[model samples]
Target chain A: MSLAAFLTPESHSTCRPVGASVLGQRLESPADIADITRRVWQDSMNVLQAPHIYSGVEMALWDLLGKRYEEPVYRLLGYDKAFAKQPYVVVPFAAVPEQTFERMRHIRQAGYRAVKTGWSGFGHGNIASDLSQLAAAREGLGADARLFIDAARIWGCDVVAAKRYCPLFDQFSIEWVEEPFDPTALNAYADFAAHHGRMRLAAGENIHSIQQAQQLLNIAGIGVIQIDCGRVGGIGAAKEIAQYADLRCARYINHTYTSHLALSASLQAYAGLERQDLCEYPMDPTSLSWSICREHLLVGGDGEVTIPNAPGLGITISLDDLQRYVVDLEIRIGRTTLYRTPSIR
Target chain B: MSLAAFLTPESHSTCRPVGASVLGQRLESPADIADITRRVWQDSMNVLQAPHIYSGVEMALWDLLGKRYEEPVYRLLGYDKAFAKQPYVVVPFAAVPEQTFERMRHIRQAGYRAVKTGWSGFGHGNIASDLSQLAAAREGLGADARLFIDAARIWGCDVVAAKRYCPLFDQFSIEWVEEPFDPTALNAYADFAAHHGRMRLAAGENIHSIQQAQQLLNIAGIGVIQIDCGRVGGIGAAKEIAQYADLRCARYINHTYTSHLALSASLQAYAGLERQDLCEYPMDPTSLSWSICREHLLVGGDGEVTIPNAPGLGITISLDDLQRYVVDLEIRIGRTTLYRTPSIR
Candidate 1:
């Protein structure tokens, strides 16, 4: 799952990389990173998986460039300094309303100014059950805290089905309804956006390319553009979308639900954009995800999280933890070894 | 590289597929095929590679369905009969105009009523060179032959560069200009289409899903929508695009270059549309590609190709050739064998 790209001053190259896990290639400029992204995209022609695989390689490229230049990734991305982002406690909805209420109450008690509950059978059931869940979440989070609903695309382009929850969204004071339809369903998104009440439509997390992100902004009529650096061809593409969204006068936010390394990578893209203040924070990550990085971007007393000023992604990887969680893999074609697990060290 | 899906009446299943190579699952209806496609898409979240891998599976599903019902795949798709398609002889531009002329002449002498020359340094060079190539192609093909130019997307998104060839396109009576830019560069396509004269803009060979194909027709403003059945989620998706194009008053054509099996699969989608007669025929495919299928869709005396009236794809796979070309592959994670090459038999 973790992929790294190493760079050296000599042996300049274009397409030769070690394997999917490690990009043993040279890094020259930002264009080289874009070239690599395009090459990977063209090679596989899988917008989603190619970006997912190369996102790590892209992060590694930026990390290498940042380290070589003795600057943080944000600074390398033309940012003056990293700004603090208001972290929203992201939690999946529980099976029942009471559980959801308790989960929201705990998040509110933890001093989070915003909370997002998504994708644990939240919108899959009847409207009454969804209403109950939304009511519980709002009541538990208190009237002042911002509440966000992540439908997780349960409606799947059913504008009418999604519209039924508009009353719940408005009644609960939901800031935005995220991904109520398939990410690529632009027409459905536009239709829903036109009819939805006060709550704004938000999407773009599933987008892998900048063209697609631009399409979402241009055609989907969504207010907020959420990008996951780990999935959207890494930080460069995310930054491009961020700039495009800024020009379009749309809100931008990072979507991270994995390790702190990923969180830092996601944050660095729009780290200097003061207006895009909100960021997703993984409240209940798996043990492996939590242990992958040595340092975490912790929420401050002001309920804001800031990226590290250190070089690269500004997060340290735990070699021991990586080794502990590594799954030894090998792929062979005939007698030739196509790929083998690279040494963690 | 080949993937297969097997269905049995007794073992009713949803998601349990054997591996990337074979699907040991049941498919009850067209909805099941769609369900599998959606599941594969959701699993990888890849529009391209996921469809690519699933395409063979999809073809297998259709093949299975057609076999079980004693009908051709087109019939299963609700087509009354497979219509004849004008087979266009597809060739690559030689290094020089003389060589291009010779190739086109040979295709014309062989009784191909249409010719398409692409890639191999056609539009990548100066406009004069491209014009000479186009002129040579037209001169060699004679005045009656339908001439097409496949730019092979060498210009990327440079509308100005592509615009420089409009005069040549019009002067040569080129039927269409194929893929002057990247497949996803819809805006560039639209911009180029706006200014380009006479010759229609053609694209969509790289499209993986029906959504993208629809986007090309709806936004790119292209007149011809070309789909590769092997890549665009197989026959069903191709049919959907074909039907969509027909409704939009745009011409639909199949883009196949690999094997006759693929050509047959591609042809089935639009076999009922008589007006959409053009079909890509590989004039010089790789030996292995030619050897994969026992029965080839050869151009008839009328200079047209037609699908077989037999059940399923009608083109039989050469099992011996498959065994001959098979490369034993194995993917192991720790001590568990995740995948091994399935038997050709």
Candidate 2:
């Protein structure tokens, strides 16, 4: 079953934290964000598969806190000014070189300075064409723009193939490879880094906490640490990781593939970084960045979007938007809306 | 606010493990259980806090697997007969000596050979009276029977008071002191264990994983390891911990203070242990054990319980019992039910 289905709007209130000390206070402190999210984390940790639901709640918290402090969420995280807000467009891979080139061209034309493409047909068949497609995209984006490739890690790329193709893409000036292999394969990463000096490896989205981030950043090859606030507990955890990542000299990037709500949180978190690199933006036209709170997340002619300076994550939800976009239907099994045996204690 | 409230019967299906490979297969192998619980553990590791709800689902899994194999759940874990089925009655402390003696007398008369009392009046005012009460409990149980003291660690006992009184109880042949200090205070436990040679320090239920269990068991002072199936992920995780505890030469006991559903799982797991020790049984009349599934969980005249040999945890739930015991009213909210805006992704 989909997690999105169970994280119903009605259920959000049940997961919200309760404490008298913070009851009347503003949600500005990183501790406040952690306190709120950790409650939900502890309550749902054994049941929820991916923290996707908690991720949404964490985004809401950042928005609330940003609004409460009359600053963007990132500024609450100690950003004196907006950090580098230039994001790389995460473009899905195409089967052919023309489709890949077309996507890269669209990204460049859209004023995006960088583009990341997925490995659509990497190992299925015709490895040469896939490498050619990467070359075509790099050539299309031109030498001035940045290019990154995502292996999706779960697909299990062959070490031999990664060795062969990494250098091939390095010739195309691919800045770094995102999850070129499994993140859990630490030895594989060390081996890859030892062999492929030309291509840097980046990963952090799957790393769950400050501890996990520290461990991953310490790995020899991973140069970029991509942190998702939701996955790492909350904004506080992400900021702590960002600080740790900077101390270790790793480039910090925020992973926001969800709605503008989460993107706002990511942007805020990235603002707290000492050495901010590039954050991920889902450039897919179908993404909620365009349809839900589209105006705030829009890109400018300078190949970067400004951080929303409005209170909270700088976005507001209207009931009309909820009515138009959200699917609301009562899901009932018999007469019981909430079905479970009452607690004995 | 209670986990049992959230882990309703309807939601059990959502958290239960799935996958075609283990769908029809019997759950006999430790590896199979590890695979199943690990999937849930990984899914909920960062988001969900305490795994209490997931622990219930784990119990259900053990029950299902037990039934499928036509062997007692313990037998599936490699046991021939019931593991030390005799349990210690977790007797709450009474303010007066008569109350303590009377309770211990009832425990002995009821065929329970072992009794554990709480550290109620120990640190509060008079330490002598509390020691006298424990001595009274000892005299009431007649010396051959086992006696344990639960400090309830969360109550925050003073170190000076514990140091003063632990030796006094030891003089009365108190078998072990349960959580004399904080579960997290490894140094305190080690120091106490070094000084107090009379009573062994016991702990386990609060621990959440095999790693934590290993760390706690390695402490020089702790002598008994209490494994709670729910607190430690599930039966597989608890079993792994039990094996580790045995290797360390610590006595193994199952911690079950909840419903009979969880107790059966704990008992089954305890049956797999090589050094089977006395398990905990809440003898309070108000407990769900009396009202929920009273007959299935009844202790025999020998103060021992036989593992449910029936398919799946051996105990079956009746809708009539649920109707009588469960709360059926909807928990009302002052505001709109669906407060949070829907997710954009």
Candidate 3:
């Protein structure tokens, strides 16, 4: 796993943006094979087919792979040698395990260092009925809160007993156990990511492409490369699948689902492949957290998320902020829109 | 294409929840998979990585193959011999090509039929790059406005004259020319769908599965098959992908984008395959045409739509009729239902 050459001469550099994924929006847009087969068979016979989701052509191929790589999509894929900033948790199940462990001890004592667990109705049965509601909210939040578990597996249930419920995900300290199955169960979570590589497992965000993340990292391979960085094609296509999943030694995370201009464009695709991993913060205030980023979501007060040192994910748009969410998402105002298409002529 | 007879009728009958996509709130029904993966990663990651877009997980596998074949998802598949009724075209695009061709020649002189056109942009490019605005809206709408040209694609531009711009889509007679391009140019539209399959040469609605309709029916292969029927997972997953694209012969259309309860769940999955096809009807009023159901999309006076015999997309929701678009998305709702480390049985 080596390839990090250097020694160049700089001019006016800095290129970050391909943060959306699942095959870079059918590869930077090329329709008209008779109008993309008449809107792909009129949306396969009339709308309602978002099975897994993420669209704007993987956010314009993660803004054309962060302006074709000058670097930032998680340090061109190394998750920044692991740890620049990653801490999430907003489980919200309409309350009750002592109010979800006092909102995970006030989002980890207001630093939101990390959190997630809210699958209600996958309830009434196993994970010991969601381990007695997080063991009665960890006996009512005694120490700090840092946990994770996401069973959604495309809304279908009975997660094949997530490995005899791995001692109930090692008694709720579950830092991994996501997507309980779907995306072809990646060889049954690669035999549950080789018997819990120290409890880390996590799944790919409903994988869209990079050959379905090289077929779920050649089945059952993920010690923690959750990636999503905005559904796989936006911090320049998650810095080309976090630089080809940082040549396999795996470990990256960015799945923050939109606003904070997609969380500083997924902290600039994990500010170069992961600083510490964890960015799923919706801070739960609703109309779907205010129709998600209808204003480009930006929370602070040291719960973290500084990163936005500028260039792209410092996000700058004011066509009345694109006419307040989808006024037909148009842009073209000025700044001589540099290079044009046909794969950069 | 003859794998029918397989009933094995025993005893299976418990299908209720008539209509629901819900998520309106209580912390947005507990942030359903992070608010449906952040309100569908911008058009679900460009309609699931385009290869002429066919993400058909069998339209939710035919809502589970017409509730395991009680039959309705296009009569379980065979699309009920392709057309008893599915004509839709509601594209007003923000109107004005002489009031959108006099409302598409008054919905084809009020019999209420097939129609789709209304994508302009003008200011700099597209109305199919202006041949005097597609010959003054085809000499001010006479041809029953069967137009269908809309230009919702241009991926910012530099499209190196996509097939020398097909003489203004052959002067707006255009019965098909929807997204124009963006799911990574499926081999430059399979070389323009093998240089135009007899002109009407259509497309799917930015497809999302069935291996992207079997790789655009094994390259440039399309006559028409458009499927979407609710994010490819609802009307039992587009009738298990129109029975696996009817052994690659291909045919289906439904992508009209929501509420006629998802076009009456795409007319019971095209009433079991092929209804000749045209079910889109989106004409516009708003809020999915006035708060989702009771009725507003309107096209009657005989213009088509009939379909609602009542059962699955036949509609029935009442939490006091969705308690005025519900709410509780949570700015704060903690009593800490914490499930800290445990040993439940």
Clashes of each: 0, 14, 164
TM-score for the B chain of model 3: 0.30
- Recovery fraction of native interface contacts for candidate 1: 0.57
lDDT of 1 by residue, A1-345 (tens): 112121111111222232432354457877777777666654444222355666777888898888888899999899998889988878778889999899889888888879888777777757788888888888888999998888877887789889888888889899899999878788888898888831388998877778788888777788799998977878998999998888778889888877888888998999988888888887554678888788899888777897899988878889998899887777677887756889998
Worst 10 residues of 3 chain A by lDDT: A1-10
Best by lDDT: 1
* Alpha carbon deviation, residue B217, candidate 3 (Å): 29
Local accuracy of candidate 3 as per-residue lDDT tens digits, A181-295? 5544455666667777623766677564444565465545766656565444344445556556666756556666444566666556546544344566655544342344444
The lDDT for every candidate, in the order shown, is: 0.77, 0.63, 0.46
DockQ, structure candidate 2: 0.08
Per-residue lDDT of model 3, residues B1-345, tens digit only: 000001111111111111111123222121232243333332232233211111222233334334443444444334443244546565543344556556555666655445565444532345344655555555545655566664444422223444455666665666666545444244445566566552354555655544555445554455565676554444444555665666555555677554555666665665644433456665544553235467433555555556653323344333344455542211111332111212222
C-alpha DockQ of every model: 0.45, 0.08, 0.01
lDDT of 1 by residue, B223-312 (tens): 888998877888888999999998878899888877888888889999898778788987554578798788998888887797989888
Candidate 2 residue spans exceeding 4 A from truth: A1-69, A91-225, A231-233, A299-302, A329-345, B1-62, B77-82, B85-228, B231-233, B236-255, B276-285, B294-306, B327-345
Model 3 regions more than 4 Å off: A1-83, A86-124, A127-129, A132-142, A153-227, A237-345, B1-83, B86-133, B140-144, B154-204, B207-345
**What's the i-RMS of each model?**
7.2, 9.8, 20.3
Q: Judge candidate 3 at residue A228 and give its lDDT.
A: 62
RMSD of each: 4.5, 8.9, 22.9
